[model samples]
Target: MRRLIIFALFALASIMAPIANAQWQEAYNNSGAFNGFHFTDSLNGWFSHIGSQKIIHTSDGGNTFDVQLNVALPFNMYDVYMEDNLNGWACGTNTGSGPGYIYRTTNGGADWIQQTHPASQSHWIQIEQVGSSIWFIGSQSVTPNNLLIMKTSDNGSTWDLTSYSQFDASWLFIFDSLNFIVYADEGLLALTTDGGNSWISTTLPSDYQVQRVSFKDNNLGYALVANIWSN
Candidate 1:
């Protein structure tokens, strides 16, 4: 299955247009469910399908999109991240039992090369990058429901692995080695103050649920929270 993607284009064309007057214009919608998308700029971007090993791209904003890469059969892309219009990576699995799979493309998704990893059946669901080449991925092993964070410094040539205790978290935010954060369980955030050596979970009040999370400094951050049952 895939999900629909909606792109919003700013409705401002003239210099005299007020910022409040700008509206969101519907841009693109695919036929099937596409799980992930990343826009390098207003004019270039790509989206990935959940199944059938497909990654679609659009160079002219959301006006059009074309399949840039598609592998053989049975490969599912759960997440995709592009560093720019020319360099990016995607992650998923190829079978029911997954050791996780990572693919790298240096030529604007014209060709994707599968990067190798160690022998652990992890189905990666989220991909993120730090700086130019350091990449991180979140994965869950199929057999035992184990979760892991995979990191690579030089593209995918080498990887460092860390296993954590959360099975339902999908977000990875790295802010140097000493301070890093990932999603904890259902309503928590996993924090690592001493790098990946150890981790602890924190959460907000029961009435609020974090819809999104981000951090700019080691101790400063923000969460988009929603009042769940508050009256």
Candidate 2:
């Protein structure tokens, strides 16, 4: 009986080892103070690092990263969205003002142009794309008090704002051309099945300022939060 139990325990341990390894293998850790991240394929992905003042591009499935470009200002890139390698957008704060700025690149970050400056900007929290439609959401300021979302179909040329006053948070997320989700800290989490024309908000548990969210596919995703305490 003792030998049988030992054999059963060994078999269980062998089965559990691979499950633990698979979970770790699926996760990717950003090296620096990361504000935004995106993965186009299993092999190609990008992450924005504030401490490094550059974006890290990984073509070998997040195994290794190559520093792509270092911006003149080491501002925090709060959100990143790319339709493909050649066309992408990075949204974040500028030297001054709370309004976030949008930076566009056509040649895969070799050259970037300031596409839009927020005359009435906020802290951009998230960026996402569905087909040719792109969406961005943020607070009226960095306080995460007033949540707002902007939708554009013709790239970033024009935008339509949808306001949410009840929620004290905002975030941008897209799973595919058919599914997009947004969560505001003010107890609002929404989903859009038909691109960005319309949205549906559902109940959520907490609004404690979720910082980062990642998705491997439409079914699997995770949200990361940091704990803060005041003395």
Candidate 3:
């Protein structure tokens, strides 16, 4: 989601004059809202809809989409990450304190099966795939007191969940399989280098806070920050 702004700015530039053979076109009906999507390549991709339990897939870019799979509620996926056309995962926040839900498809969305994870009754809003590890970050929605990070290094066969208390944010940026950053609120950010086993907290100045960050490596990165009194 953090990278969306970068894409939007680039889109605006191209849209002003159009690009050779590339143009924006409608891919779906104007009926309901589609929340998130992932594409394995230019021709194969999938999109998940809100307000429903259905997921859509298209092999010809966005020209046509077929109903791929349906799962349980909160009835919408927060994100979908397709490693390829054949293997992928989707996740979302649950309703009314239900267990955080994750769905996996190993056969190109031919079938989507729910996978079990270690966060007992949590809400997952983000899923990132780094190498063989599938990482998820979520909480209870009511509070970040139950912030949970779930990881699976060997596909969906096994999962490792670690919870961190005293955090007030949900978004996380994984620089690699083990090194990443998570917002800790109150002008602080948590940095993890051992696959979230431990954290070294860094406090920002009294007047600034960082909302998002991207890392080129452990020693170099960039952040989107704002003043404490800004809107």
Candidate 4:
């Protein structure tokens, strides 16, 4: 009984021991809302702020945020992609008719160059990288035919218009590097098997607006929905 009691006490102490915690410091604080955060690990990450016309980057986690660039485009960055501690990309939408922009950084967030996109500057809503390339989707209701899909192989140097769909502000995710799936407004869904070259739209009878979507792999996915109808 005494031996069992001592063992129990040792187990309890081990369970109650404090874990080694790493401290997170406020790396940067701009005068706007930070829309998205992407980090591969605690040492490297990127944050986008829309109202401030800036993207904050940290090579050593959130301990420091340096303004990589000041494009100050008319859009608010909603999402960011960091391929490594150095390579990163950002995509967001503009407020007015100004088209959105996709910016890339190669020198560890020291500077960013905007990709010369064919469509209007205010179109891209969300952007992410799937392997060595980056993909984005843009919407234009007035143009009716301006719903565009773009891909960049050389980081953000240039973009190729790959597909067109009448979807607005769609959320895109890539699985297995080239396979992708997008869920747009009005229950419109799309799947891409060859990078972003072609897409097939699927029907989803959902009354809620899907704000974000993530996939653990090709088989399992989780989506966060807002503006849902309870009735």
Candidate 5:
């Protein structure tokens, strides 16, 4: 019986070892603070720094990184998204009371030009690419009390802004040009299927703050909350 118990324990340990090792591991370490990162594939990826105006790109799957597009100070890079190796966008603020800015790189970050938009006059937080549409999630001011979602189909030449007043959105996930989800700190979850023209709001039980949300499909999704509640 002793031998049987030890064998059972070893089998269970073997079964659980793969699950424990599947968590996130440190791939690369740098001196600057990375606010957001996205990879087009395993070979190409980019990361933006919070305090600096530069972005780091790795071509060989993070084995090496090269700094590109160094703008002046006071313009922090918050989020970066690359549609491909050549076309990419980065969004951030210009310090003080200045509006947020979006920079685009066509030749793989060799040159980044600030794209002009009406929403660029606000504090942008995140940028996402959905098909041919580009979405910008941010606030109207630097303090970021008012949440806004701006979409541009013509690649930042024109923008349509959708403002939310009830809940302060923390993060957003775009499923497509028409469907997306936005979650807030106070258990607020909003869904939009007809683009940002309409939104359905749902509140989860308890005061659990929502951190992030993801959907496997249009019907199945999950939300990450800060705390768990008991019955």
Candidate 6:
């Protein structure tokens, strides 16, 4: 009886293995190159493409995607963030020779309006939101060595720019309106506890480049580092 029970358990495990290892089904196919995708829930999702001027949306868990916004070309959407089904933002470069843009969609990506900035810029790679304020971080082509950090308090109506003397700013992580962190090119990390008025800097091992930094809260955080190969 003991041997029979063990054989039964093994047979049951074999039957359940296929269901656990099921493959992901292809949901949508398009000619444009897809760059970024975001899903707020199981049923609602959005995706951005590089060559296309429109953003795709799906209401049925990606079974079918519809063209949600038909903005002009050259604004290749690089990243998208949605607070919910209704409020969201997308960022990308102009592909021509002008500054990039931050677009906001309040009605579930059906319509997007470009937000005004303090100056013409290049690319905005990341966006963070705290309450009603939004923050953007990206590089500017002032001399091929300029990095910029911009913030908007009235939901992208206006922006303010901050620069760090030749350091290439790559990522922005916001803990709140008063505190945030930025990762730079040369293993440099900047922390601000009293808003953007001042900052404290710390340098890690010079050989490793900081790629990304994230914080779970004010006290706990993690940094991803990559080794810089030298000639």
Best candidate (score: TM-score): 5
> Is 1 or 4 the stronger prediction by lDDT?
1
> What's the candidate order when arranged by decreasing TM-score?
5, 1, 3, 6, 4, 2
Query: Total backbone clashes of model 2?
Result: 5
Writing each residue's lDDT as its tens digit, candidate 1 over 1-231 gives 222211121322432466756678877664656877899999998888875578888899878778877777677788788988898988877776767778889999989888888746777877766555455555556644656777787877777886665444356667866676765334556777896677787755544445556654666576554554422
Candidate 2 vs. true structure, TM-score: 0.65
- Candidate 5 or 2, higher lDDT: 5
Number of backbone collisions per candidate, in order?
Answer: 5, 5, 0, 8, 0, 1
121: Cα error in model 6, Å: 3.2
Residue pairs in clash, model 3: none
lDDT scores for all predictions? Answer: 0.70, 0.65, 0.74, 0.65, 0.75, 0.73
Ranking by lDDT: 5, 3, 6, 1, 4, 2
lDDT of 1 at 219: 66
* Least accurate 10 contiguous residues by lDDT in model 2: 1-10
**What TM-score does candidate 4 get on C-alpha atoms?**
0.71
Write one digit per residue (lDDT tens) for candidate 6, span 56-164: 8999997888997766665777777888999998887776545777789999988988876765756776776788766676777456645677777776666778775
In candidate 3 the C-alpha lDDT for residue 39 amounts to 86
For residues 99-181, what per-residue lDDT tens digits would candidate 5 score against the true structure?
78888889988888888777544777798877778888887764456778878887677888877765464578888877888
TM-scores, all models, native as reference: 0.75, 0.65, 0.74, 0.71, 0.79, 0.73
Stretches of candidate 3 above 4 Å error? 1-22, 31-33, 141-144, 184-189, 197-212, 215-231
lDDT digits (tens) for residues 38-125 of candidate 3 = 8888999987776676788999988888988766555557777888789988887656675767888899989988888766668887
Q: Put down candidate 4 lDDT per residue, 89-123, tens digits, no spaces.
A: 77776676655667777777787777667766446
lDDT minimum window of 10 residues, candidate 1: 3-12
lDDT leader: 5
| Model 3 lDDT-worst window of ten | 1-10
Stretches of candidate 2 exceeding 4 Å from the true structure: 1-19, 22-31, 62-64, 94-96, 117-119, 142-144, 172-231
Q: Scored by Cα lDDT, where does model 3 land?
A: 0.74
Model 1 compared with the native: what TM-score?
0.75
